[model samples]
Target: MASALQYIEETIICAEILRLMPRFLALLLRALIKRCLRSHEAIYVTLLPVADQRCLERDTRNLGHDLPKHADCIQWIMESSSRKAPWSGKRVVHELMAIWFGSVHALTTTVTFAIHDLCLHPEYTEPLRAELEAQYIQFLKSGRGLPLLDSFIKDSSRLTLVESSILLSLSAK
Candidate 1:
């Protein structure tokens, strides 16, 4: 349902098809719009309370990076929306919903691809599991921990970051 909304936006850009195929476009648009509306309603119900909390925070201004409570992405979007023309409740809800839809799409795609890759190479699964079990926390910025997990995800992305570089260099020397 959420994904249909994304496709509908893309479909709207080519206006010729919309004009040429009224019945088909109308059916598609009607269905997607209905789904989007339902998604909006569900997210709005969840986000209204958070927006209220944001309004409460507006007066006190716990708006600093130093503040521990200011960690939520939905809160950040609400705070950063528009100072000149404050967004309506509906607009805010839509924004939050859009963010959630994007996040969920990314998560699902990555997980799907990862599962496929893991199945393609079964040998790394146990070592990767062991690496995760040994580490309680990972500091990805400094690369202080969880090298195996990092390499597992990003090694295919970049050739230089692989652990086998050391062995290759030793063989050459």
Candidate 2:
């Protein structure tokens, strides 16, 4: 049997026609919108009937009315993708859902506990704040090339889990 990663690669490489069509339409719509925007025309355009056209319209209207031009450009780049090759829409959605769940839960729990710990350990507040400031200075000096800051942030994340059992386990022989 193929490994899980291999199976995933194969599935993405052979995505169905129905799965591929919407993504292609989305890309075309995005390109047309971009062209319209650059030509000083209205951002709204009639999109091909697809499930995601409403989403596209909402995003475009919000961009034209509310978001700054630079932000809208960034959003367009982030959201649009070309579908020249097969990619399983179902698999992409599943992966995104998993990441959203993991990040949201982990970040929320970590921040909650960090605040609680800081409140309980008031004596450490000045020192911790000083450390943060020192790191910020170092980041500024190095043009933000601060691996140590990243390490510290990651360590802080590990130390403040919602439950001890949520930590990863290591097996010893």
Candidate 3:
């Protein structure tokens, strides 16, 4: 049997690993999607021209060049103690680890529970599928409306009980 300290250490390590895993999986999936999209070069080119062109431009300007430097500066301040100056790498890594922890824990638990509920609720599956299909048709017909789909998603998420911890954490934060 493990000692108490050993058990606690193991638990912490396990939690850290769990936190890191989803970030890794997301990175992998994003790369895979990018690769798949690149493979369909013509389709991408045709759609790229008109697909929320301003939104794309805004994201490009706001996201990459501006955000990371500001985040790094804040991270540096957070990592610095009064007595000692902060190292940049340590600050950046610490902030990244915090982000990984928050995103992975919440997203993994929510998605896992959602999948499990969908698997268990065989009777509701067809109706839910039909509802989604009908919603898509309605969305195409109307300029904007996501009522049925949004409600279904919200209800499913509520029933899953996955967001409780996330809500608590957000409140604490």
lDDT of 3 at 165: 41
List TM-scores for all candidates, in order.
0.40, 0.34, 0.34
lDDT of the structure predicted as candidate 1: 0.54
TM-score of 2: 0.34
Error of 3 at 157 (Å): 4.1
Against the reference, the lDDT scores of all candidates come to 0.54, 0.40, 0.45
Which residue pairs collide in model 2, if any? none
TM-score of 3: 0.34
All candidates in order of lDDT, best leading: 1, 3, 2
Best by TM-score: 1
**lDDT per residue (tens digit) for residues 30-86 in model 3:** 445434433223323343343334224334554565433233433343435342442
The segments of candidate 1 whose C-alpha lies over 4 angstroms from its true place after superposition are 1-37, 41-76, 102-113, 126-143, 154-173
Judging by TM-score, tell me the better candidate of 1 and 3: 1
**What is the number of backbone collisions in each predicted candidate, taken in the order shown?**
0, 0, 0
Query: What is candidate 1's CA lDDT for residue 117?
Result: 77
Clashing pairs in 3: none
Query: In model 2, where is the ten-residue run with the lowest total lDDT?
Result: 164-173
